[model samples]
Target: MNEAEAAVLIALLHARPRKMSWSAIASEVALRGSATALWDECFPPTLEGVNDLDGHLARAWESLEAWRSEDFRLLTVLDRKYPSRLREIHQVPPILFVRGQLRDDEVAVSVVGSRRASDRGRAVAARIAEGLVDRGIAVLSGLAEGIDAAAHTATLKAGGRPIGVIGTGINRSYPASNRALQAEVAKCGAVVSQFWPGAPPQKHSFPMRNATMSGLGRASVVVEAGEHSGARIQARLAVEHGRPVILTDMVVGATTWARDLLARPGVYLANSTAELMDLVDQLTRTAAGIDDWSNVLPDLVDH
Candidate 1:
């Protein structure tokens, strides 16, 4: 099948009957045939309870046509526009619902922290975002309150790209206040989700959102986070995805998560914008051309 057809098929598969594991989807695609042929040749028992082959295929096609009628774009793993870096994650989503745009080669850095950020923390997050944009890096964040809001606003103010990886469906707003901000991101950058179009923002959805945030970025910076902050989990997941995690001196001194992250070899500590930029340079170089990001980004710092 074509990429779009395969993508829609996967999207429909997840929407009904039951959601299959991402690895299973990946393996089926590896069979080197069209998705329709794969489905025909190997109908897993998972869908047997729902309907016969013809019935299931019809439902899949119907759902694909329905979603296509909307503005949302379903990207399957087989799509060329699908992000390579995100595929490195342990539990990659088989289908991503995108409402805006995605650049295959842009350098993005996720800046995140507590929803209940201190005033100082908010200021710092904005500063970091501004700095990242000055060097032509896109600012990535969950479109939540506090630090996430601060980062996205600063990115927009700087006329830089802001990628909002959200928990709720692409059409729905989470945290409510970010409704406008999310719209702006869709206008100039991207607002993406793996959830169905009407999926609500459950407590569990945030972690799923964080994983996508961590996966897309070159690295993640935690400006400020309490001990129980979700940013801490994002930082951990970033490291697991083979990206460096940067924390401010303030964050490093604030909680056990920071202290332990500081002990990790790939993690780095920064106290100022200058230091953060310096660390970014050092880490990218030491990553042994994890990507030739510096060469590709002429507007980057030190370029």
Candidate 2:
């Protein structure tokens, strides 16, 4: 099938499938080796009892065209332009609607934390983001207020790419205040969403967005977050994705979750900007195959 047809079919599968989760649909498509083939098998046009399948396909096509006209790129799991690291995660979205470019080999680190960030936390986030920029790495975040905003703003000022993996649709901005910042990121790097083009922010979407954020980044840096902060969710998801997580001393002292995660493999504690950057540097080296992770964190090694 052509790219457009495949993309539309994936969207239809996401919308029309009953009882099957998007992940399930994605896995089935992967296993079947083609979305078109999966559609033909499960929802053939001549299949009995399948209602309005054609209408759904027509709407999906219209949505795709609308997104394209607005310069939003639709990337399916089948697309070569899809972020390669993201494909490694179990919670990989079936589709991504992106407002900017996504480089398959881009080296990025997620800098995320509490939305109601303390001044010190914001400063620390900015410092960490600037450091990443200096090292020629892109900064990825959820594009929320406080820590996420600080990181993106710092990355922009440092003339670095700022990738925003947002909870809301690529066409909509959450918290409203960051609308301009979202647009700037789209221009400078990317604003990515797994949701359909017009989908609004929902309670469950942020955690899902966090998962994607962790999947996209080389590692996640939690500058400061409280017990219930979404940053904590991203940190946990990062560890699950087998990506390293760097937590600030403040966060560890403030949240039990942070303290609990410290014992996990690939989770590190950073007491200062220097320490954070050192951990990030080690992660970069490990990703490049220049250094072994066990050499960097011997305690994390299995005896």
Candidate 3:
């Protein structure tokens, strides 16, 4: 693996996934490229609590070997297989462990919400997911409780490829209840994690995982979120990455941020997938920019 890729997996092992800042990571790579270019070239290093570079490198190597043996595959930012949309995000994960198939569908949308979603929120998410999937648009979300779970299930129920990006390890599901859903995702779509196998779900992992959800999608539809929710953070990240943020007032009583997001200059306001599908259809027609990885490392393969 390249140094950046190694660093990213190491960072995940370090439990400091969010610490892989763009400028700092770019500095580490020694690549004379733009921040976006550098992000596309390096993996987020997981070097938590290591004061010495040598010690960090040593721990990273050990983590790499352990991850490799467990069938955990790494897709470096330099890899051609890296998602183009995700590469656009500034806080994107440098290295991702993919457990299943990742489709090259042109239109991908993330459906996100609170972990403790209301029944109405769950129904809406499922409905939105079904509508998107029926149009051949890929549904992406965190495989969490409530709305996220509803979205993934609806997509699979519609016989569509639904991508589930998680904060926990691919081998273990957080909340534990979604284990079967995780398996279905691996079978029908993909179960992706920046965290290595056996990595615990720490408090910070949730927000860190949100960037992946937003980056992987052309637009994100947030059905519900509290004032300072991770879902809300993801909506902002989507805007930062130049993807449209679609806000839905799923509940009768919604926060000011939700209303404000709806009124934002570039953010799209949608109450249902029918309204959002037009945007998905529009984005789906665009061709992905070709990104070749052959020049980066020549021939370095790591699981």
Candidate 4:
């Protein structure tokens, strides 16, 4: 089978009958060097009377074709189109369903915060997003309301790329009201999801989405988050992924987690937009090899 077909099969393995976890499948496939080989081993055609598995595979294949017809692209770890930065993370998804385009060379930074953001928080998010765009970096975020909306809107207004990584299936929109915004992001940049095309939003999916968002970006900026916010989860994941985390003064002052995270490497606190932009500049330069990366944040260099 071709890689694409194997990817479909692997995705199928994660469904009802087989019910294998994605991480387990990813690890097995990586070790085996081919999802097709793994699938064949798991369900040998000669082994027997598995009518149910056969039906499920057929249905999944049909869904794959339908998704393709609707302009959705399926990218697996086997595909070169999968985001390289994401592949470096431990929690990398086995597959990604994408609605627009994803360039391997795209330089992005995630701007995340609370869904119930304050006016100042929203303004800060927008300014940071605009500054990121001005520096030619793509803005990445969960397509939720409040701070995420502000950042994405600012990025679009600046005529910059806005990548929306949603918790729901790429074909579905959460909060429902952001459907148009999601479509716009898909048209202007990309809308990405790791779940099946028909999967609905679940309580646990948002944190998973945050982990994926952290993996996709070179850094994550927490504009404003409460102690228990999803942005806080992303901040923690970013640090674990060895990516930098930038917390605004407001966030640092408001949340214990933000203050605690400061003690970790690759984590910085920005008191102003200028300071935030300066750190972004330093990071960009460091990434480009134009400057010493260690000098940007001495502790982070070791990671």
Residues 38-150, candidate 2, lDDT per residue (tens digit)? 66666665656434455766666666666667788778877667787877888988888888888888899999999999999999999999999999999999999999999
TM-score of decoy 4: 0.90
- For every candidate structure, what is the RMSD over all alpha carbons to the true structure, in angstroms? 5.2, 2.9, 9.9, 3.3
Name the TM-score of candidate 1: 0.85
Looking at model 2, residue 247 earns an lDDT score of 89
lDDT of each: 0.77, 0.84, 0.70, 0.82
| Predicted candidate 4 versus true structure: per-residue lDDT over 184-299, tens digit per residue | 99999999999888789999999899999998888899999998999999998888887888889999999998888888867888889998888888786677532222246764
Off by over 4 Å in 2: 14-18, 45-54, 289-296, 299-303
lDDT per residue as tens, model 1, 100-147: 888878888899999999999999999989988887889999999999
Clashes of each: 1, 0, 7, 0
Q: Report the C-alpha displacement of residue 117, candidate 1, in angstroms.
A: 0.7
Ranking by lDDT: 2, 4, 1, 3
Please, what are the lDDT tens digits per residue for candidate 3 over residues 31-147? Answer: 443223333333333456433343554677676767667755777665667776665666767667888878544567899999888898898899889888888888999999988
| TM-score: the better of candidates 1 and 2 | 2
Model 4 sits at a Cα RMSD from the real structure of: 3.3
In candidate 2, how many clashes are counted?
Answer: 0
